[model samples]
Target: MAGLSSRSAVAIHALAMLANRREGSLTSAEIADSLESNPVMVRRVLGRLRDADLVWSTEGRGGGWSLARPPRNITLYDAYVAVEEGRIFSRHTRPPSGACEVGRNIGDLLDAEFQSAERALEERLDRTTVADLLQRILAADKEPADH
Candidate 1:
């Protein structure tokens, strides 16, 4: 099945790390290190978060990012939408010269269906806050060692 963009996942992961840190601020390099990705990618995601007002960055030496508000106020939907530029699902071009009735309307029909599904997905995400995600991550980290 189709999935959320990798950028969405990466943004959430970065936010969760910030939420977990008692220090409340982390440099982009540190976030990149934890994500095992490049600092530029982390900064790009952070730039979007900053635009969304979900995160704030400091300048100069010891500069870093911090959540703009409490985790309980941010939803997964917020993080996802902040980075997504186009429609969640894109429609391919029309089929060759409307060869068949089905081909003619298929894109429109699929687009409608996708929009409906996306609405439901967004509603579910709205019910879950970043705080909930952080709790899950923390619980997983605390799981007992397996033999």
Candidate 2:
């Protein structure tokens, strides 16, 4: 299964939290508390998001972080790309040994397949905005308990 990097997930969570509480900015410490993680890690992820223009940070005691734009304008794909270091999926080494005919071509074939899959994932993510995600989460929270 393809799993999101923790940094990517943390960044998204932090931005979504800010979107939900748009009245004011939130410190990395406040975000870390809600995420059950360390403030340093939160700051690191926030730094990446800031570089991506997905979020903005301010300095000083009262300063904190906030989304650069409305949540509806941001997509999960945006968050994913912000923290991705390299190819989403990468081969550890050249695929099979060159001794066999199939071995030499396998890597190319696999690379094409990986690229296609990544494109599809990006398309799907583009259709989903942070606003959509937050709405779904809030809806689930409001569901009546089964007694």
Pairs clashing in candidate 1?
none
lDDT of 1 by residue, 11-91 (tens): 999889888877748999999998999999899999999999999999988778999989999999999889877767767
Q: Model 1 off-target regions past 4 Å?
A: 1-4, 145-147
Candidates' C-alpha lDDT: 0.87, 0.86
Distance from true location, Cα of 25 in model 2, Å: 0.6
**Global lDDT of model 1:** 0.87
For residue 13, give model 2's deviation from the true position in Å. 0.5
Over 4 Å off in model 2, which ranges?
1-4, 92-95, 145-147
- lDDT tens digits, residue span 99-141, model 2: 9898877877878998898899889988989999899988888
Question: RMSDs, each prediction?
Answer: 2.2, 2.2
